[model samples]
Target: MYTTKIGLAPAIHDSFIASEPLGHLLQSSKWQEIKDNWNSEIIGFFDDDQLVASVSILIRPLPLGFTMLYLPRGIAMDYENTALLDYIFEALKKYGKSQKAIFIKFDPAIQNLPENEKVIQKLKNLGAKWMGLTAEMHDTIQPRFNAVVYKADFDEEKFNKKTRQALRKARNSHTIVKFGRDELLDDFSEMIQKTEHRKGISLRNRDYFEKLVDTYQADANITMVYLDLKALLIEAQTMFDQAQKAFETKETTNEKKIKQLENACSKAKKDLSVLTDLVQANGDIVAVSSALTVNFGTHTEHLYAGTDTDYQKYYTAYLAWFESIQYMFDRGAETVNMGGLENSLLETDGLLKFKKNFNPKIEEYVGEFDIPVSRLLYPIVNKLYMMRKTRI
Candidate 1:
């Protein structure tokens, strides 16, 4: 027999969730503090004194003394365990009634594969209203599709030619990747603002970034990519001098070799001049890109990232992403989630195109579900919510 316990200890709850296959950081007790505006609780299911299931629920107060319970990423439990699922859902429904909740909302991290159809049907059998499989970005509370890189070890060779070339160019241009906590937040925020202006979409602000860094503590990091113009200028000047000398010496008697030398000298001279002017206009070093990552269990999430459009040719974003992934892998992560992607999988989508270079596996998640507590109020609230989301 299973018994439900509310207000489970944080460490105990986290340990149990981390052991589950569907464990996620959003379901962590710490995440509750991040979403402090919502009244939250950690509920655990114990079978013979052994914790077998857990969910961190956020309570949103509604009009007329009603409430809505949301389980972000859903409960961490074995979906194959029908008995446990039935018990947990029954307990949740009772709990919702006690709180005067209109409904309970959840979107599990499980993939929408053929094998998982039975699990979806099981959820519906338990009275969950399955929000249809959606592909658009705004149709659900969380994205239905995600780009994830799953590997036991990091390998640059696995990346496609374009990605490898971009990494090489960033390295050749003297790009420096640095990792830190709040110290790098300013540069990260600046790059994010630039990205927002370029893409015309507002992402998280500085305060939210700061909160993430602070809340996650050692589990989170900000990786910044910088270009040392002074170093590049010196290197370019040296290359130009060498090319000019090689051309003048006429060391290669072949006409083809002579032409190659001439072109090399001309290109080197142009690069040297450009670097010199850039060094004069800007400082010795400038930030070009940055990424924010959070580590939980064996998974690392590349949550937010930004790059300066002016340095697009330098490919600093690629370097930042690569180094961040390396950092997470070294820290014992088996998977690095590259965050959400549009489900349409359009070839013209720049985000999808960029992530595809890394050869990520696209995860199509089972969409949201709503378990009605108040039959009449559930329909009204859900309809209003959908209308509001459509407008946004």
Candidate 2:
């Protein structure tokens, strides 16, 4: 006795299963809250009066008075239940036709599909066209990915040996590792910045990272990694020294002001030195990584990770990741997902290679699947978007 209906609005039935951030990130968050805001409708699916799935569709106004329905992570449902998928698509198609949507693009979270071809074939048979991975992710909503997942009974030793030499190296190094968000954020931000810079990319400023820490810190599962005082001290001293030297050369005629500035500098340097030693004394060693463990029922995903790449030679990143994985396993996590990456750009790229060294089995997923409601107008919109990209 199964029934299907589109829950147009969020309500009590949606609460049947305990909610988590993944669900919210996929459904509940306001349309405007997403960094790439979309204008359109969001719908949730219910079965037998129980909420089971949800979807967010972005309808972009196109030229010649047409629009398109772009579903980032669309059509969330019970993947194993073919009937449920069929019911949900019928509801979506009906809804799309009414709104004059050009197409519906869905990227379900179902991974490790036994037969990718069969699933694609079934979708096509269901009137959902298969859009191959062709364009850059910007052209689509979610990027095609091969996620690295640690299984329920993952062997830590096996994973370490298969992945990277660094994890062992990190353990051997005398670097202090501290977990939890109570630790200093400025240091973490700096470390992340250094890593990003090394990879020839710019990272969000300290404020953005601080927000992640502040928002998720209360959750005991969220962990932060810390490197030793010696490493922190080296960078801190270097930055301070450079600033102090520059300040000394500035044309300042006031003797009293100069003396006051010198005293401040001296104290600051002294404090920095002491703090460095303090961190060094609390040794866990080599490197550290901070991560937020997100739980959705029994499934847990590692959201964001910040690591000390400066000590890569010592394999701090590997050590930090290995320990973190062990920590997640101990917490009864069914899956420890490393999260998605810009794989196309990274494969063969040093960072990609580094992440791969961990011996993670690839979880291949569809790049972006779209169901066009009105194909005629969608092209015009696509052209304009391409033009804009070219201009940028």
User: What TM-score goes with each of the models?
Assistant: 0.92, 0.66
Predicted structure 2: clash tally:
18
Give the clash count for model 1.
0
The best candidate by lDDT is 1
Q: Give one digit per residue, the lDDT tens place, for model 1 in 1-392.
A: 79989989989988877767888888988889889999999999999898999999999999888899999998778999999999999999999998899999999998999999999999999999999898698898888898888874358998888899999999988888899989999999999999999999988899999999999999998999999999988998899999999999986689999999999999999998888887888789989999999987888889999998787889988899888988888888889999898879999998999988777889999999999998888888889998998888
* Clashes within 3 Å, all models in order: 0, 18
Give Cα-based local distance difference scores for all models: 0.90, 0.58
Candidate 2 structure quality by residue, lDDT tens digits, 1-392 = 34444345534322422253233234432322333445656566666666676676666665555566766555555455788778777777778887777667677654435566677777777777665654454544554554555564356555545354555565544455665553556656666676687668766766765555554344325354545556556656776786588567857888887887787678668857765765666552333465555443345555556665544555566656656666766766556666665646555666556556555666656655556565675566556755896665
Cα miss at 145, model 1 (Å)? 1.0
Q: So what's the TM-score on candidate 1?
A: 0.92
